[model samples]
Target: ITVEEGLEEEEITLPPLLIQPYVENAVIHGLAKKAGGGTVAVHFQRDNGALAVTVRDNGLGFRQEEGQAPSIRHSSVGMTITQKRLELLGSA
Candidate 1:
């Protein structure tokens, strides 16, 4: 796991847990199932007056599953919560 921060603004405030779910997803779902494991790269960039976070992993890409898996459900929960949080923050 590698974290790269390239923020144009030195000090920026962020809401709680805004970026953690994505980083966790990158590790848990993306890199954990690889043959010899893989790299999870997280980048934080400030663009204009907003923040852009990217979580990238070099691992096995998506494959078709027969049915809904537990991991899929877990991911959905995390993403759903994160999406709502983003919406709330945006409205604030």
Candidate 2:
């Protein structure tokens, strides 16, 4: 896991578990599937007036079924809850 903070000295606070699921998925589904393992890179930066968080992994990606929601396709309950929370916070 590599975290890159582009904000320099700026400090930021995120809602708990907001990005945890993505990292969990990356490890459980991405790196765990590969024979040699892979890296997960998480980037945090200021994009315009908002905070940008990106989680990336170099592992085999999954295929989604037709008309399936991403959270459902990935079977990520935490992600689904996080999406709902974001929607409620008017950030989605």
Per-residue lDDT of candidate 1, residues 1-92 (tens digit): 33335544455466788778877777777777778988878776666656667788886656566333234544257867888888877832
Q: List the residue pairs that clash in candidate 2.
A: none
Give the 10-residue window scoring lowest on summed lDDT in candidate 2.
Answer: 66-75
| CA shift of 40, model 1, Å | 1.0
lDDT per residue, candidate 2, 1-92, as tens digits?
33345565355568888999989878887777688999999887777767678998887776555443233344457778888998998888
lDDT at residue 29 of model 1 (Cα atoms): 73
lDDT of 2 at 82: 84
Counting clashing residue pairs in each candidate, in order, gives 0, 0
In candidate 2 the C-alpha lDDT for residue 60 amounts to: 74
* TM-score for each of the candidates: 0.69, 0.75
Deviation in Å, model 2, residue 25 alpha carbon: 0.8
